[model samples]
Target: MKIITYLFLISFFTLVSCQGNAQKKPKSEQFEIQKTDAEWKNQLTAQQYYVLIKEGTEKPFSSELNKIKNPGTFICAACKHPLFKTKRKFESGTGWPSFDKPIDGGVFYSADNKLGYKRNEVLCAKCGGHLGHVFNDGPPETTGKRYCLNGVAMNFIPTKK
Candidate 1:
């Protein structure tokens, strides 16, 4: 009887500790722009909705934004919140739009363990739209942080003369 009780206590503590590490997602209402699933689906194209709303990734090198070399700002497709500027963009050879940083308060991060390991998931601060992950592998001369993003999740607005 005592053995069984000890086992139960151990299990309970283990579960509680693990739950502490789980990420807590912010409620939709916390965002600057909130919308229902149907509303978001109606507003975004199929691909954009997939990456931005569903937290899905796009095929590497598939986005035309990857080839954009002009001066511009990348804004969230869901809310038009400014994210990355052309000056921060870099060629990471990873077939994604890589930036060393984002505009102030333009994005946020959450712990992502969907792959059975830990990763930092980036999201738009205004709309809570999933952008992509950030990594430490970036240009050393720069910020040394890679804000790898999905092109379908954003639209580039070229700077006007």
Candidate 2:
């Protein structure tokens, strides 16, 4: 009876330790850091350069994506990392583009913002590029989080028809 009880306690402790280690593991992949502004400019377009590097926002409703409906993957214009998908896109009627969710932890949240209103800012986790702001006001059936992204900051990779 004592042997059975001892074994149970030992197993429980082992399981807990393993779980803790798993939770502590880091998820991001390390990459060679690109360090110069000139290098980024050379790689991205003028609009993409402005938005992704300088943190500028494109004029609202000016993006071609305001009417885009095709299926595709949206990638970071600066780093070419996937950021959002067509299925997550939705109209928030706020002029700029909106999404229900990011491509699985692709974005990291931070305190925004140049505007007077304090808001939660979102950035690309990989390259630390600015994407947009996220708000809680969204369709009830969806994630209930509105990711208001700057279209210039992203490039749409259309799915093959």
TM-score of every prediction relative to native: 0.84, 0.74
Write the residue-wise lDDT of candidate 2 on 1-161 in tens digits: 99999999999788656544344323234432454778888888898888877778899998887777799988887777888898999999989889999899678776653553468877787776778899899777988999999998888899998
Range of the 10 consecutive residues with the lowest summed lDDT in candidate 2? 23-32
Error of 1 at 101 (Å): 0.7
Residue range 1-161, candidate 1, lDDT tens digits: 99999999999788656644345464457688888889999999999999998899999999899898899899999999999999999999999999999999999888887765789999999999999999999999989999999999999999999
Give one clash count per candidate, in the order shown.
Answer: 0, 0
Q: lDDT (CA) for every model shown?
A: 0.91, 0.80
Distance (Å) between predicted and true CA of 126, model 2?
1.5
Among all windows of ten consecutive residues in candidate 1, which has the lowest summed lDDT? 19-28
Q: Listing every candidate in turn, what is its Cα RMSD in Å to the true structure after a full C-alpha superposition?
A: 4.5, 13.1
